[model samples]
Target: MKLLTHNMLTSKCLKGVNVGYPLGIVAKDVKVLETEFNSEFVSRIIPKLDWDTLWNAADSIGHAGDLPRAVCDDYENDVEFLKKVHHVLVEVEVIEGELVCPESGRKFSINKGIPNMLLNEDEL
Candidate 1:
């Protein structure tokens, strides 16, 4: 799964959890695939992203060097910064990993670039 997808995921569906957003990533395999950069697309997505969560997730997988702690005010005109954001948001892929819910500690396995987010009956 792409970091972009991971940024939007949450584990709030689990029982007794208030806010299950920003699920923790434990990546065992990571791949960086080349993607064509679109500054407009990156700029559009910046507003929707949770910057801190994205930064932490990228850091967890050892890829946060280029990401800023917060989205800068002048990001739209910053090509270099946008390129870094684009790389993290689109190019980085998690091949194998587990997404751990912060509140419940439930783990969702990711394999072959797919994250299995289905909860067991008891979990629901």
Candidate 2:
């Protein structure tokens, strides 16, 4: 899955998880696929992202150097910054990994670019 999708996912569906946001990424294999960059689209998505979580996830997969620690207030006008965000959100792909739920420590495996978010009956 792409980091953009990961930013919006959570484990809230699991039992006893009050806030399951920002599932941790444990990427075994990662790939960067080239895509046309649209600064406008990246700007639009910035507000919706959890900056800290995105930063950490990118850091985990060795792609955090270009991203700033915090999303700057004037990010919308910063072309260089926007490009970095675009690369991280759109180009980076997690081919093999596990997304760990912070609250329950549940692991969701990702294989061949597909993340298996299914939970067992008891987990529900």
Candidate 3:
């Protein structure tokens, strides 16, 4: 999954999980592919993302590149900053990994870049 997806993923659906946000990543494999950069799209999506989660996820998988810990002031107008954001948010892919819930430690396996978030009946 892309960091954009990771930034929004949550394990709150699990039983007894109050806030299952910012799921931990255990990336056994990661890939960085070239993608077309759209500055406007990156700028528009920035507000919807959790910056810390994105950074941490990228760092965990060693794909953080030059992304900053904090979104800068006037980021929309900053081309270089936007490019960096676009790379992390769009280009990096988790080829094989598991996403762990922070609250419950329940693991969701990612296969071929697709995360299996479906829970067993008991887990739900």
* Candidate that would win on lDDT: 3
Q: Each model's TM-score, in the order given?
A: 0.97, 0.94, 0.97
Across 1-124, the per-residue lDDT of candidate 2 in tens digits comes to 9998999899999999989888988989999999998989999999998989889989988988779999988998999999999999989999999999999999999999999999999988
Q: What is the lDDT of residue 3 in candidate 1?
A: 92
Regions of candidate 2 where Cα sits further than 4 Å from its true position: none
Cα lDDT of model 1 by residue, 7-68, tens digit: 99999998888899889999999999999999999999999998888888889999987688
> Per-residue lDDT for 1-124 in model 3, tens only?
9989999899999999999999999999888899999999999999998999999999988888788989999999999999999999989999899999999899999999999999899988
State the TM-score for model 2: 0.94
Q: After superposition, which runs of candidate 1 have C-alpha atoms over 4 Å from their true positions?
A: none
Summing lDDT over every window of 10 consecutive residues in candidate 3, give the lowest-scoring window.
60-69
